[model samples]
Every structure is written in C-alpha cells, then in structure tokens.
Target: MKNTLLIIFVLFIAAQIIQTPRDNPLSDPQKEIQAPKEVHAVLKKACYDCHSNQVQYPWYANVAPVSWMISRHVDTARQWVNFSVWEDYTQEEKEKKLKEIFRAAYAAMPLSSYMAMHEKANITMEERKLIRDWTGVRK
Candidate 1:
C-alpha cells in the first residue's frame, strides 16, 4: 500500500509539471457581438467562461489534472463558438452559432458539471427563453 501511494503521489507531482494554457486574449469591445443587456448578462453568466476569450479561471483551474481538463474544455468550446470574435464571423457562421447557442441552452448548458462549481452559471428557464428569443429559435 505504501509503495502504491508513493507511485500515485509521484505521478500527480509529475502531472503538475505539464503546463496548461489558460490565456484570455484581449478582445476588442467594438468588434464584439451586439445583444440586449439582459441577453448579454445571461450569456456572460452561463456561457462566456468557456466560449469567449475572457475566461475567469477559478482557483481549481490552477491545479494539475483539473487545469488540463479546463484547458481542453475551453479550447473545445472556443472552437465551437467564440463570441469574442463574433463580429468576424460570416453571416452563415453567425446563424450556425446562434442555433448552437439556443440548442445548448435548451439542453441546460453551462453544463451540469460547470454549474456544480459555479452556481451563478446555472441557467434559469427565463434566461433560456431570453436566449432563444434573441437567437430567434422557436423551440
């Protein structure tokens, strides 16, 4: 048991040396997505952390395995829809992103795991409706 514990501890320490990128690049406000204040508020609370270039990394995000996981998730989220560069997207891309946003919100995103850590990021029904209305998604 002692040997196994030592090996596990060594592995964890080694993992810590693996760097995870947690950059939040500067975004031009003038080129950002335009939306109503309420809509923006909801998105900021529930979506921006992963989907934008303005992620507010929590303390846990500085730890090893968690940091790696967060970095991967943020990368994936930004790839799917980066609101920080919304104005740069083509009209078709904008439409696709809008549809994705509505669908994700309807499915209770911020993701349940994310909401578990960030209670404020939990999407309410009204907030979801607001997003849907803004995106012009009927369902």
Candidate 2:
C-alpha cells in the first residue's frame, strides 16, 4: 500500500512537468468587439476567459489534467469565436458568431464548470437578455 501511494504521488508530480500550452496572444483593443458598456461588462465577466484572447487562467490551470482540459476548452472556444479579434473576422463571420452568441447566452455558455469556480461569472437572466439583445440576433 505504501509503495502504491508513493507511485501515485510520483505520477502526479510527473504529470505537472508536462505543462499544457495555454496562450492568449497579445490582442489589439481596436480589434475587440464593440458593445455598450453594460454589454461589455457582461462579456468581460462571463465570456472573455474562454471566448476571447484574454483567458485569465486560474492557479489550478497550471496543474496537470485540469490544465489539459482548460487549454483544450479555451482553444475550442477561441475557434468558435475570439471576441478579442472581432474586427478581424469578416462581416459574415461576425454575423454568424453573433447568432451563436445569442443562442449561447440563454444557458449554454459561461460553461457550468467555469461558473462553478467563478461565481462572479455566473450570468443572471437579465444579463442573458443583455447579451442576446446586444448580439442583435433573434432566437
């Protein structure tokens, strides 16, 4: 049993050495999404971490398996829509992303796991309406 525990500890330590890459490239503010201050506040609170080029990784994100999951989620979210580079997208792309954002605002976003750790990021119904209304996309 002692040997097994020792092995597990060693494996856990070894896992930390294999750091997952979590990159948030330098973003141009001019390229970021333009929205009313209220809308931007909601986005900054609930969406930017995963959806934009402004991920605020938590301390656990530097640990092993959790880091891998966080990195992958951020990468996938950026692929869907990196609001930090909003102006870089074509108009059509922006429209599509806005539509997606409109849908996501209802309940599918600010992922549950994320909200579990970030209480401040939990979007209220009013905030959801704000995001959807800001997107200018209908259901």
Candidate 3:
C-alpha cells in the first residue's frame, strides 16, 4: 500500500509539472529605460524570476500542488511589476518603480528564500552596489 501511494504521488507531481505555464514576455532593450548591462544582469538573475515574465521554474515548482502555488505567485507578481514591459510605464513611474526595486534588493527581500534553492539568485555585495548605483543614475 505504501508503494502504491508513493507511485500515485509521483504521478500526480509529474502531471502538474507538465501543466506549468510558459509566459516569457520578450524584453526589448530599445524600449527600456537605460541602465548598464551589469544592472540589467543583476536584476535579470535575481529579480526577473518573480518580477518579470521570464520565470525559470525550479524542480520543486514541477511537483504536484507546488506548481500551482508557484504559478500563482509568478503570475501575480508579474502583473504587479513587469521589467520586460518597463518602457510601457511613464518616466516618473519607471523611476519610482526602479527605486522600489532597488530598495527591495538592498533589503534582501526578493531572493532571500530564492537564494536558498537557487544559489545563482544570491547577490554579491558588489552586485548589489552596482544595482544601487545604477538606480541612482536613472532619471
């Protein structure tokens, strides 16, 4: 009975994994508010997973029910602030949003848990400094 239950659980997880949605919003640099590539890379690696449309799901996101939670979070967060569609926001709004993003990253909010699972999401002090510096330069 235990073995049967395990198999059922595994199958359910696999099915949920197959249901993960793909929502990659193509980023057009031409339309984006200017920032150094280092800043962009920092945000892409650390923030984009949740804040943008390009979410790189982890293995656990494929598990049953886990995928549902992750999908919901990703969808909701993207709607709140989409870096891929950054240019769509007004100039003042973009600056305000960038300031908010900088504050969150500096405070280590976005990837605190994310870094535990995905080490690459962990920001080095220097990387954080770059993001902060670039955020200041944005008008």
Best by the TM-score measure: 1
- Across 1-139, the per-residue lDDT of candidate 3 in tens digits comes to 9999999888886676467675676787666545688888887887788887667877777665777777887887777678778888988888788788777767854655567777877888788778778778442
lDDT of 1 by residue, 58-91 (tens): 9999889999989999999999988899998999
lDDT of 2 by residue, 1-139 (tens): 9999999999999999999998889999999999999999999999999999889999999999899999999999999999899999999998998898988888498898888999999889898888878888666
TM-score of each model, paired residue for residue: 0.97, 0.94, 0.74
Q: Which stretches of candidate 2 lie over 4 Å from their true place?
A: none
Report model 3's TM-score to 2 decimal places: 0.74
Q: For candidate 1, which ten residues in a row score worst on lDDT?
A: 107-116
**How much does candidate 1 score in TM-score?**
0.97
Q: Between the candidate structures 2 and 3, which one is better when assessed by lDDT? A: 2
Comparing candidate 2 with candidate 3, which one achieves the higher TM-score?
2
Give per-residue lDDT, candidate 3, residue 47.
78
Per-model C-alpha lDDT, please? 0.91, 0.91, 0.75
